[model samples]
Target: MAKPFRVDIVSPDGLAWSGDAEFVVARTPEGEIGILADHEPVMASLAQGVVSVDAVGGERIRVEVEGGFLQVLSNQVTLITDRAVIEK
Candidate 1:
């Protein structure tokens, strides 16, 4: 079983998501990046693309992030965004 990490997705408006995830994949200025529990620390500028998180139940939740900054530290991930929408 994979360890779960805290992931928070936020925009200028407010927090769009707050939960635990096994993995998170998103686009950064450089390219696509994947984060797992106990991942190495990182900070990067994000691009316009989809941000997906694998939940405990193995279900994937995706959201569109227009532009933002992503910071990963310890077992926590923080997303600061200009715009984002939950993908149906």
Candidate 2:
């Protein structure tokens, strides 16, 4: 089984979601990027689009972010946006 990493999706309102995920896919200014556990540290500008998180189990988390920044380091991913909506 793949190891899970910590992911935090946050907005100016507050933390949209925080949990453990096996992988994450996010849109950046350059393009879409996929991240897994122990991924090399990076910081990039996010694009206005959907961000998807594959949780430890079979669940998936999706959020629409207006625009922000994505930071990954030490098995942790942080998404900071001014606006974000959790998709049901």
Question: Least accurate stretch of 10 residues (summed lDDT) in model 1?
Answer: 54-63
What is candidate 1's lDDT per residue for 1-88, written digit by digit as tens? 7999999999988999889999999899888999999989999999999999997778789989988899999999999989979888
Which candidate should be chosen as best, given lDDT against the real structure?
A: 2
Candidate 2 local Cα displacement, residue 73, angstroms: 0.4
**Per-candidate clashes, comma-separated:** 0, 0
lDDT of 2 by residue, 1-88 (tens): 7899999999989999999999999999899999999999999999999999999997998999999999999999999998989999
Q: What is the Cα-based lDDT of residue 71 in candidate 1?
A: 96
Our model 1 lands, by Cα RMSD against the true structure, at 0.8
- Model 2 lDDT at residue 39: 97
